[model samples]
Target: EAYAKALRGRTSDHPVALPHPDVTSQDPLSKGLGLMERMAEGFALAMDDDFNSREAIAKVLGGVREATRLLD
Candidate 1:
């Protein structure tokens, strides 16, 4: 919610908000998964300069899958 409030003008409201750090996927349905995918892709590209952290890519893929599953 804090982030949403901060970006209210710049970005439209997201479907969900991260209230608890421990909780995962505040996105309702698969709404925010696109953001996750974009982040993962960007991270993969950014980390490619270091060592192409495959683990990070895997984690992001897992998150995407998890979020998608929530919609079902």
Candidate 2:
């Protein structure tokens, strides 16, 4: 939600502005980031479904740690 809003509001003038690629563009980085976003969204939804489940929380945290490692 926040990310989608930020992307929508971005302008070419911004220092780190992304290229306004066509909708059909097969950009690998974009696709990878999109997949990550989906993974995060799924984690959020799962947490909502079972917030008190220790197993679910641990899995999501492990995923987040892995993602942080990849980013680093």
Candidate 3:
């Protein structure tokens, strides 16, 4: 959510801002980052289903780590 928010809030060409690209020309890394976003959505759903926010939080961290490793 924060990632998407940053993308929305940042001005164009800002360093450390997420790139806003058209569907056709985006880099593969952006596609992978999209998966991280989907995982966050899943984590939210899991939290609602299981009612254990701790697990949801862990899942979010794991997803972030995975995304970081991918970027690195």
Candidate 4:
């Protein structure tokens, strides 16, 4: 989008394809953790070389799945 804007060409806005985070044990749905913030943090971590620690991201079984998709 930035590139197109800079070039003065048409910029199409496409919705980002992303998955939902894990739902906690206490909540049937997600009780919520600043997901957008976590996603941004996850992307930052996903970009770098090492991903040894998943403790923060993987708190439960569903979290493990979420991490798998996020990192994949």
Candidate 5:
């Protein structure tokens, strides 16, 4: 939400704009951190004592690793 707002514009009404810390970064680590954060959210939301949930979390982790490697 904040990211989208930053991408659009910032003002009293918008309250976010370009050149924001999250929007201005061109660094792999920064981007990777964002991805990791999202993955963590998904993991938390999907948590359960079930095989499918565990498998899904594993897949998300794998994707994060692959993305990090590509960003590298």
Candidate 6:
């Protein structure tokens, strides 16, 4: 809930912010980092499901697969 609320206020690019002051968009590593963060976010969202039943587990597993698709 808190996480979703926080994301609700961000621009699409906000999550891609650099970790270091010296980093720039031109850095190849930045692209990889952005993808990694997005993938991690997907996994987090999957695990954050409020449901407590079996359906929730299915949602989580689906989310995990969706997030990992970034690796392909």
For 1-72, candidate 1 gives per-residue lDDT tens digits of 445554564545555454332224454423454556556666777577676677667667776675676557
Compared to the true structure, candidate 4 yields what TM-score?
Answer: 0.24
**Model 2, TM vs. native:** 0.42
Q: How close is candidate 1 to the true structure, as a TM-score?
A: 0.35
> Which segments of candidate 3 are over 4 A away from where they belong?
1-29
- Highest lDDT: give the candidate number: 3
lDDT for residue 26 in candidate 5, whole number 0-100: 67
- Per-residue lDDT for 1-72 in model 6, tens only? 334555676687676334422223443344445545554555556556663445555555654564465335
Q: Of the pair 3 and 6, which is ahead by TM-score?
A: 3
Candidate 2 lDDT tens digits, 1-72: 435756778778873455343323365345446545655666677678857466556666765675575456
Q: All candidates' TM-scores? A: 0.35, 0.42, 0.48, 0.24, 0.43, 0.35
lDDT-wise, the better of 2 and 4 is 2
Residues 1-72 of candidate 4 have per-residue lDDT tens digits of 333444464346654332244434333223233343455566556545375356434434444555565445
Looking at model 1, residue 24 earns an lDDT score of 43
Task: State the TM-score for model 3.
Answer: 0.48
Worst ten in a row by lDDT for model 5: 16-25
Lowest-scoring 10 consecutive residues by lDDT in candidate 3?
20-29
Each model's C-alpha lDDT? Answer: 0.57, 0.57, 0.66, 0.44, 0.58, 0.50
> Per-residue alpha-carbon lDDT of model 5 for 1-72, expressed as tens digits?
446645567567655423322312565445555666666666766675354587667859865785767456
Candidate 1: residue pairs that collide: none
Which runs in model 2 stand beyond 4 Å of their true positions? 1-14, 19-25, 52-72
Tell me the lDDT of candidate 5: 0.58
Candidate number that wins on lDDT, 2 or 6: 2
Q: Write the per-residue lDDT of candidate 3 for residues 1-72, one digit (tens) a residue.
A: 547676676776674655543223346446565766767777888788868787788888877776676567
